[model samples]
Target: MSVKPASSNRPLSPFMIGPYYRAQLTSMLSITHRLTGLALAFGTVFLAAWVTAAAAGPDAFAVFADLANSIVGKLLLVAYTWAMLYHLCNGIRHLFWDTGRGFEMKTAYASGYAVIGASVVLTAAVWAFALLV
Candidate 1:
C-alpha cells in the first residue's frame, strides 16, 4: 500500500498545526519566560487587589490577608515567588547578552543552564524560608 507523507506538501503555519516538539533548551526557556511573565502579571493583580482592600478598612484587609495566608494561597505564593525570581534572573541574563557580551556558543549554553539551576535553587530556598518563618 502506497501512502503519501502525512503533511503532504502543505505549508506549516501555526494555523495548520500538528504535533511538533522542537525540544531545544533555549526554545523551552524562551517559552517558559513568557509563561512566567503571565503568571507574574496575574500575581501582581492579586497583590494590587489585596492592597486596595487593605486600604479600604481593617475588616476588609484582614479578610484579604486571611485568604492569602490559607493553604491554597501559600502554595500559590511558592509558585509565584519562583516565577518572579526566575523571570528576574533570566531578564538579567538577557540584559547581559544585549550589551554585546556572552554571545559565545559555550557561554550561551552555560548561562542558560546556570539560569535554570539558579531558578530551582532559589525557588527551593524561598519555600524553605516560608516553611520556617
Candidate 2:
C-alpha cells in the first residue's frame, strides 16, 4: 500500500496578483511606468521615421505630415505626449526612491498621485501650446 501526500488548496505563489490579490496604488503606478517606457521606445521609432521622411524629400515629408495632422494621428500624438510626461514624472519619483526616500507607504502613494497629476497637467500644457500658439 502506498501513502498519498496531502494536497493543499493554498496559492502556490505569494506573488500571484490576479483574483487572489488586490492591486495597490504603488504597484499600479510601477506597472504604468514600465508601460510608458515601452511606449516611449515605440514613439522614438516614429520620430526617427519622421526625420527619415523629412530627409528623403518634401513628398515623403508631406506624407508624414498629413498622417500627423489627421484626427487619429492627433489622438495618438496626445497619448504619446502623456506617456512621455508620465514616464518623466515617474522616473523622478524613482530617483527619489534611489536616494532612500519616499519609501514610506503614505509617501510612496503621494508621490504616485503626484506623478499622475503632473503628467496630466504637463501634457495639457504642451498640447495647448502646440495647437493654440
Candidate 3:
C-alpha cells in the first residue's frame, strides 16, 4: 500500500516574509549593518591601493590623486565615509545588546534610528571639516 503525503495550509519560508510577517525596523537595520560591513571591506582595498600608489612614484600617486579629486571619486569617498560611520554606530549598538540592554521593542527601535541619525550627522561633520580645512 502507498501512503499519501500530509497537506497543510501553512506558507513556505520564502512566502512568510511578505504575507505572514512584515519586516521590522530592527531587522532592516541589521541588514544595513551587514551591507555596510561588506562596503567597508571593499573600501579598505581602495585605501590600500591609494597607499601603494603613493609609495610607488609621483606618477602612480598622481593617478590616484586625480581620481580622488574627480566627481565620481568624491561621491565614492562620501559613501565610504558614511559607511564607516554607520558601521561604527551600529557596532556600538550591538555592544549594548551584548551587555543585555536595549532589548525592549521601543528601545531597540529608538537605538536603530539613533544609529542612522548619528552616522549621517557625523558623516556631514567630517566632510564639512575636510572641506573647510
lDDT (0-100) at residue 42 of candidate 3? 86
Worst 10 residues of 2 by lDDT: 5-14
- Between candidates 1 and 3, name the one with more favorable lDDT: 3
TM-score of 2: 0.86
lDDT of 1 by residue, 1-133 (tens): 8899888898654432235654667767877899999999888899898889978999999988898899998888888888998998899999998999998878888989999999989999888887798
How many clashes show up per model? 0, 0, 0
- Candidate 2 wrong stretches, greater than 4 Å: 1-15
Query: Scored by Cα lDDT, where does model 2 land?
Result: 0.90
- Top of the candidates by TM-score: 2
Lowest summed lDDT across 10 adjacent residues in model 3 is found at 5-14
**How do the predictions measure up, each by TM-score?**
0.79, 0.86, 0.85
